[model samples]
Target chain A: MTSSSRIQRRAFLGRAGGVVAGGAAMGARLAVPVATAEESAGPAATRKSVAIIPPVAAVAQPVREALAASYQIRMLDPFVRFDQSLEEWAAGRRAMGDSLRGCDAIVYAPEPAPDRDEASLDELTRGTYDLLNVAASQKVQLVVFLSTLELMADYPKEFEVDEGFMPTTDTSVRRMSLYLAEFACREFAREGKLRCITLRIGQLANASATPASAGPLSVSPGEVARAVKAAVDVGFSQPSRLANWEIFHIQSSHSQARSSTEKAILQLGWKPDQD
Target chain B: MKVLILGANGYMGPHVVRKLAPAHQLRITDIRPAPEEIVNEFPKQEFMDVDVTSVEQVRSAARGMDAIINLSVVRQDPILAFHVNTLGCLHVMRTAVEFGIRRVINTGPHFAVAGPSYEQMDYRISPDIPPHPGIGLYPLSKSLGQEICRTYANQHDIQVLELLFYSLRDRHELEPGTGGVPFLIEWEDAAEAFRLALEVDSKELPSRCEVFFVFGDIPQMKFSNKKAKELLGFKPRQDVSAPWKRG
Candidate 1:
């Protein structure tokens, strides 16, 4: 058996645009032209409704307050608690849909919590999809997902870690749960369901609490808020051909920072004015 | 070696059990209890009702087992799809680590790796390609589950082999052409890969995690079965390509 017969290269493109666009949404959502809101354009055309999803209500306050300063920040009250029974989840799904309607963008920060067990983490990962489904159905313009810098924590303190650097292999239910949530969001973006930007923020502590884990890369809590706002307004960076899925690593400036924050500053036009 | 089959109530699980029963002791589990025939056949054997979504139950199932084969999955129902197919893998891997189990055989459909995207380009398709599960629930959920198993295998001392099948046919009937699933595998041929995966030496695998596209040879050979053949020494006893031949 000659190698030529065993492997023959055919002369066909096999149809361009092979079926990846209309993911899980099935058929219709692809045809419905999604609404696009200008990135914080002119004089207050009724401030674009930007919803903040902080997993538990306690995950992000500074980020919420910062976003609230500029846009209409809608906090999903009670949150989508999937730990509840199936009956509750049925109602919760509907409630989550109700919460996301008419939003221009969403900032999903499913950060870790000390009290969250493995089951709750699983719930949070799935709940993220439910939230994005509603957001996509409503034709929400953009989603700024707040992932963590800790996921890629294996590199040296002096290493120049970019957004493209593969994350750590940590399979703890907590870390893997967050990574899986990001994976789902990427498919939605790749399918053009909605414009999504994942901001992997560095370790941060609010006004007077000790940092969660000691690290050379201590980000100011306020920088995280600014990154979220800038991500919402980054539409100005590219008007005609904005990428469907983009990732930016934002961290405070340090003499010995672990990961580089150059992309966030250049693309989102972010600032590093330490509070 | 003792084997534990999680989600063993499905159509394929019984065939796998039938093949392994004589040589290996088995424990089977699923959301529903085993079928009556299996209960009667494997009388006095332990059959636990396990919901793969529950970590507690998954952990309990892995205890005292040498190897685990996960056949559980949910194709539709958006909510339950991710919970059962995606998180189910996480629960199983977590249990494997807790119980110090060394090997796991995870199963999913070929579409999980070769979705509508890959289907469009039809030649020499293999499981080595990056998974573009598209947006379908079954593919997306199972692909994510594979990712979890891959991560677990890379991080820990467990060896994970993922078997991706397209369609399984009856040997006697020998249906040809890509009717339902584009690729076809004889039922016995598909079930036999599990035994090869279980018995293969850990040193033979190129990495901690390996994915195999399990199917028999076809005339067009749109999908390649070479990887499974070379790695696990899988041979399709049934002549799958014969029906495609013209007299």
Candidate 2:
């Protein structure tokens, strides 16, 4: 972190640049046209660059496609293997810092294997912090952290949650890790140099799968992609609110009464395209 | 003024003792008994053995002090680290409030904010950077200690000044660097920072809980001490290498 007085305009540009032309057009009925470099020259850079960490997860495919269609995309593999030593972790952080340069935004989705041991989970936690430090160093405008909504798995059958709901009593490792990630992001975001958006996603269905008839809450990969787009768009359009730090619950509209997507809709101007 | 120094046997404690002994009535306590040399030298000052981890001992040691400076820490033992670093801080703060000690100085390493993993070594760090997760046990516990300070300062009628120190070394020592980390401060400069922190008027400080980075003037500095300079009148009298230039 630089002196507060010397924090560069790139920090402001990263957060407020998108709002110059697109502020008034954002809301429930947003129509974002694919902007070209020439069209977005003044304050709005048409070709913004996004770096996605651990880029190959199945849930990220739609997000990658959506971002690629609109912005230049950089895929970063933050090598956070379970077996790496502290030295290797530092080396990886240095490498990630190199990749973060010139990027306007970053999407971090570290998909640890389900059967990963405690050591692997610890590494994943460190990796996430390393990524944040690199992004903060580069002063990336927006960071979309993809976290699981499984933290709320113990909620009663019809319980609905919003961004304001607290998970004080939960002690599960998955839940605690997500909470820690959010806390770490808040540390950077509170400084106003960077904007952090946490999307606590529900169970991810196949990109092409239809809505389940009934059972558990799940969202298709494409819907997840749309949620990511909405988060980025909101970050750009509403610099005052979303540009600081905001978390939203994301699920397909079809998921019956298990989780609430109201905050996502009202806050980020996002609604699942599929019912 | 009466000042209580916790963890008075650490590396930087003697320097602080030397600086403050001339003006203030000092009471120095640590888990280890105060050395006979310090006791003989500062005959007017009081020295005792008190474990900061014990709330009763810390409270008893803090009874008559106008202010408290907590320097006690455990770096290696994971369980003792939290007990002494985090919970001990809680004890200190609670004792301060009970004793009507309005001004408190909490000492921690730069790792409390910049993290020990060397992840943010490339960037210039100020007190504002959030504590990176997985900074291992020592720094994590110290960071938690800071949070405790913040909580007490906000909820109670006490003012807390947290001074985050970087490499405490002598002027002639080769700059400390294991893997590209560039921040360092001389022992004298760090002790001076503590003295200045103690001397700064409450009116000059902006909030009840404030943090400042204390390090020497190194070129292309990795950690900025501007806040310390501006608010606490900190002036580094030592020069260290610019890590970026060395490589």
Candidate 3:
């Protein structure tokens, strides 16, 4: 059987419990020790090709810089823009498949925007479906899906809303779109069509210029991009710890941090930069 | 009560309309016109052409209604699935809030809450737990709508009753030995559950949004329909466990 099949088979075997205990939505994740040099999945000797499919160019640049040295990065904004007519989506999806042909993995980070409305959700689903379809067809090795921490904003402020906690989202189109997009991602991962690492980042702000909305939920874009790179790099790190699907909380360790990035820390070797 | 039934052309819509028509004032709306037989059966019932995907259309269709029963579902197409299954929900709830309609009945397959993630491993799962709607587009999209309904119910005064079902079989035609169905409800029995949901007082419910697994008493013990029985007083008339035969 292929590696993908092994992941698929493992998907059924490890889930003795429904959802991951520490991580919220990922199917099955295990606690494993760090791999030795020989077990390093992603060797830095040769840079791999990765496609960064963010919601916009603004979010793509930081991630590009983070992965520039470790992997050759290409941006595919259309895959997550959620702006396409039915015909346009279908045609663009076919074109997007070609764009993914040479990439080893895809980083699909779709953040909710202020301008996003309810009507754009159809496009959101279509875009995500297109990405997964194209990624599967093109034999992309992995897909790191970026979700938002806002989905869990409704949890009590004093509560420690770790990755294990269930996500709570409101009816706004912005948050709902992200919530829906994550579902699509979960399904694709469950099928084992593509190994996925869903990083639910907290209030994402630029490393240099903090957005006004930054607070306890704040995690610098630099940290998020680094997490994305670690998600892509092979140390045999995640394939061993994560099931075909894995969800990890990505955020800074604030005094009042809402999420726990323990799974990301152990599984992906993702560490948040403390300042 | 003046009820607005959206997507009244699906499999279970006719059954609900048939059951509710004599007592309640229903304005049935669907993208396609109701069959001549249905229109002819309830001459006094109002019928309109409306697509749930369009918020404006749903809003217009919901005018002067006391309650709304949303049965809109699109399982197949990639794009239309979200349009109808996911976004259609937002329109329904927004309309409910706008019209001061406090009662809304939402429907979806059991996988909307208990997908492969739960079904294969967990037995006797209840609908109240956190939903783990895995990869299938049909369930995933519909579950998204379910959440939207829950949000509206919690935020607004609207009462959303999500009745979940997986398999609907003719009571007499049930195949033997599980028939690859973990949960099965009689077609008519499933329709009756909707009526109970519609009639149950919103004040008596545990919360503004509640989920119930609407199925018959199956022998597989794969799920618990006790919540439906206790809350909505939903009792299946058919012997749903006949397929197992106790063999």
Candidate 4:
């Protein structure tokens, strides 16, 4: 069998095995008829439904494949665009919410369009915050907010960045955004109402990336999808009690930023077979 | 091996103590009497009162210990930064030579050898990078600390390894709405890194003084553990957020 096939098979079996193990541990009372994937004794083929919220419809095709293969994901196309008209956006937000209300989980990858942030960065930030609430009020089991890596450009001098150390305080705008999302999620998680996982994605290698932005430090749509699957089914690193907010930066195996990427490969079990 | 750690009361001090306790006969020396409360905390170890900057105090603490790990520094007093980092380090190195200690592991920030600007670049600040202190007493003092290792390696034949780490967010979560990930090392991972550093053979201490970054294997952490993985064989398994898991 091809290496990629082997990996996919292994991933499937591992996930399937985990569910079966969980069910078996729960005893006969919890046993259910779970059909394993044919042609391979792997995890059940049944996929979990996921709702995706993006800023615009510039949906990367590879990302679509990864999510569809692993999850029963519902894509809210023509991604949300915020303009001067609040009323117009509200109608759109409600439509987006109505479509997503039935999914088991929500995934947000909001990329502010050129016009969306013309009003101001604050408006864009607030608009996304409102979208998150749409998911929280519905009590989705999991909400994964995609994010970016903690690049040096992201922070001012006050917060230091080292591969092996954490700066005592971070004053970066990028860092601040992540903290805000986690903070919002914490209030909801407090009542055991919802679970939130913030993914600090690396630079993605899609048509969206320019010559100046391509490299090892970036992530791909496919990689992000696999990561989302890993996070949703394989499970996430727990939420912080300091507020149940968790953050993860997703990057592919070929990150151009040498040491940090190498460290990720060795430490976390993340490796990208595709470029 | 028996190890002595100075600054046992500081932020990373107790962690060094806990990490080394399992394999080495650990002797911790702080400026003040390690509080009864804190001493009672790590039951299997011993504590001593020693002002690390003093030659005599450090010399006394050096007796019977095979190596020393220094973490104490002058916080507000920038002038004193040189004294503790340079002179104080001189005292520890001299004492180690006199006592026939085989190895010494020093704590330095990753920036000790690189500038804040270099952080954005795609490179690892290996020990080979010339020590470059940008601004701030902390980085400068740490640079001097790196120099101390160089001096000891050249003159006294004492082997020293400097460990640099960042993204260690065990103390507080990044405030909400920030892309700031919990790039943190739990108290456990911090301890383990030091433990591995303390155990490495003096001969294994790479010539020209080496720097290794240490921290937990969080997906979003900035500090990379690549070198530590190769040299110390240290792998951190604990996820700071894992303990918060629930159905």
Candidate 5:
């Protein structure tokens, strides 16, 4: 089979085989068939937990602060954004593992470096996989990633310049970033250890945005916090392809200047407090 | 009372066991093979292997139990979302009815009330939306599952407690977002919600069939927890700003 076919098959089977039975025993795996029912039901309580792993940087501080309000979260990256030593980074990851040892869910924020150089993307990608592996070891329940919606729009030509593959030209760069984020989420959802979520956030209307527009298409840090809280509070149905690795456009209701992201707000029950 | 826990081995199962073990006789069933450690912990709880889809197995498994807390779902199949969530729910409810059991606390997502759009802001969603749009099968399935619960409540005289659960968390994996809106109900709060649903009077619930948001009192809660509080008397004790305790 071709590599693409293999990947498709893997995705199919991963979804099919991961049917979790809730009670005395979960759905039987073909391999395990049926273990003693006594062995099935108790681990769920003691075994499951979620962890958040954010990339350390000036930009991510707000995001980190937002996650803390609603989740049992821990930040793994050092405060130093660009100046950390190799030892510091390693210690940070090791420390992350220690923090995540007993958890079953992981909300990951893998920040893209200012320069999307091959080395930076490659390192971030590899590091992402490494985090996935760590979650797998701990049987983490879900993996949520903060992906960029603007990455596609703000630098569409640049992204094409950087990476030879561009999937579609139909949508705007921002919408395309949402799709790309989904692609990455699909790629990383392996071993059932990682259930990726790419928050295709629109232009963040923090205090940092240049010359303010009169339109209502802006989102604030406070709004982002409320959105993330909704994502966390809304318990998930079984982690399936339904919403798994899905890319959501993150914006407020008033930001309906374009279309509205009322769909996400409705799904997770998120109501952002406006400035 | 003899109680049967579906998904008895899940994140909230052990906690359920902890809560229910004090007074009732508990039996747990799941698809996962029983873990040795849990066996050692609750030696008295009988574990059984039965798929909720199989009506015969459900009937047989539910025969002597007073209540059934279903927590099973199709993990991978988007198409099976409805079948597992709705049909499985129907089967469990029907089984409960057959066995003369009245109370059933089934696990459901808060998204059943809201949809993908609701994820952006924390707001109250009425249980009256015309089912979730078929965005994906999971929400559809969950919406259908809620329908089944309503059917059982109306037709079979079974009291169904649908906990519209969201962001249930442990200490490590939880992420309380920064915005002032509260979301993510801590696991302890979830436990309390279920416990109250299990213990509270049927009249005390919202309408004959009720949908309660099983979330902590995060400042920016997507679904309103007021009904849950009013009916079930569950007050979330966790702080909304503790994790991101901002100035």
Candidate 6:
């Protein structure tokens, strides 16, 4: 594909329009229609509503704060804990469906404790699966699934794996679960039900520390919050593609083997804030 | 027909084995030994403990078989998931080509081409669309496996049938929205798709490497299985939804 086509395929809505408009201007003079009163007011005149699922996680708090700065934020209750009978699971699915209704978009960040055992892991898996289903059923326009950079563990230690590298062949439950979540989001995105942006986050520093830079390896919570906000903004602005999904490696900038931040920079207009 | 079935202990393994038992001579292999009931039921069929990830084991079992059907999958474990789903496929395709096996049937989830998120639920998705094999390791690995099949098919002139299944379970077990997608397939219907895939004359196949959506007919959903219906004669025998009206 031509570089221009690739950009059109991968660029965020606003930039993509600029590219198209640039191309059109060189071709022919076209009649422009007069703007209506509603059209003149611009997209910002109406605030887009975003529903944040399980707003209790550490990541969720920063993301919520960042999003609340621009969009109208709605916090869905914490997801039903995984250890429940079939009846309870069904009820939880229904409850999730109810919570997501009328929301323009959703931010899903399930925070299972780090020391979770097999049962808890299973719960996490099931909960994610159910949540995806509910989101689809509710017809939410965009879903920003918070995934971790741990998926990069399987990459050769020396290789600087970027978003373009295909996922490695690890089969650990954690990696597999994250992979499945990514799959579900992409599947929904492909079906044109919503736009899914998977932020493969790096190691998060303490909330208080102002990291000097977004090094290639690690990122701070504040950086993550900003990334989430950028993604949410793009999701609202872009017209969802039938196969509209993207994976970006969110990390601090580095001189060594740059953790390919080009896609995030170009698409989301996101640059890591070192200060 | 002499058929080698890998991952014969999975949920669909026994059903497939039982379905193919009457007409085809079968050799079944899995990491675990085949259950005794299956052994007793199909006394003529041979069972072997074969780990698909082990190229040697797979090569050994694949010898002298007319065709190979890969059912092996690891969903939860990342290491084994890649080993089995991706590398295992490489072994199967390579072995099939080496042994002059003409046809291979590979099973995978529908997410391979269904795009990741449900953002485009308004129109039907056909098999020909470039696969958007969503983010997770399972689908990613499986999609890679399909790529392997495509490579072998194109390079070696082998007929590779990649069946993209939505959800495969018994009719009684299927719920309204199986696997969180608007599509599902009863085990029997899935088995029938496989059987028909095996029976379709190679000359009739549109391409050497082909993908077919193997799910119960759900016109209401945005996925189309018309290719499977027209090419392989895949007649879905069960509709888990609205079961009372099923004929």
lDDT of 4 by residue, A15-70 (tens): 10000000011111111111111121234345556665542322323445556666
Per-residue error for A138 in candidate 3, Å, reads 3.5
* Residue lDDT tens for model 5, A71-98: 4445453221222345654565565566
Give candidate 3 regions above 4 Å deviation.
Answer: A1-45, A55-57, A79-87, A159-161, A206-214, A234-239, A252-275, B171-180, B242-247
RMSD of each: 11.4, 15.2, 10.2, 22.0, 21.9, 14.5
For model 6 chain A, the run of ten residues with the poorest summed lDDT: A15-24
Residues B1-247, model 5: lDDT tens digits:
7877776776767767777776778777876766677777878878888777566777888988888888776644532444467557767877887788988888777666666555553356555454432333455457656665775676666788888765566655444343433457667667777678888888775565777766666544445777778788889886544555552
- Select the stronger candidate by DockQ from 2 and 5: 2
Which model scores highest in DockQ?
Answer: 1
lDDT of 2 by residue, A49-148 (tens): 7776654555555787776767777766665544455576556666667667777888777554424433333334445555676787898989998876
Q: Put down candidate 1 lDDT per residue, A93-130, tens digits, no spaces.
A: 66666667777888777653324555545555666676
Q: Per model, how many backbone clashes are there?
A: 1, 0, 7, 47, 96, 37
Candidate 1 chain A: 10-residue stretch with minimal lDDT: A9-18
Q: What is the lDDT of residue A50 in candidate 1?
A: 77
lDDT of 3 at A274: 49
True contacts kept of 3: 0.68
| Per-model TM-score versus the true fold | 0.84, 0.52, 0.83, 0.43, 0.45, 0.51
Q: Candidate 6, residue B14: CA error in Å? A: 6.9
Clashes of 1: 1
**Which of the two candidates, 2 or 6, achieves a greater DockQ against the reference?**
6
- Give the number of colliding residue pairs in candidate 6: 37
Q: Pick the TM-score winner.
A: 1
Please state the CAPRI-style docking class of candidate 4: incorrect
Instruction: Show the colliding residue pairs in model 3.
Output: A24-A163, A41-A234, A41-A235, A41-A236, A42-A234, A42-A235, A187-B135
Best by lDDT: 3
Instruction: Estimate, for each residue in B9-104, the C-alpha lDDT of model 2 and write its tens digit.
Output: 888788899989988899999988777778888888898889997889999999988999999999865346666876677789889988899999
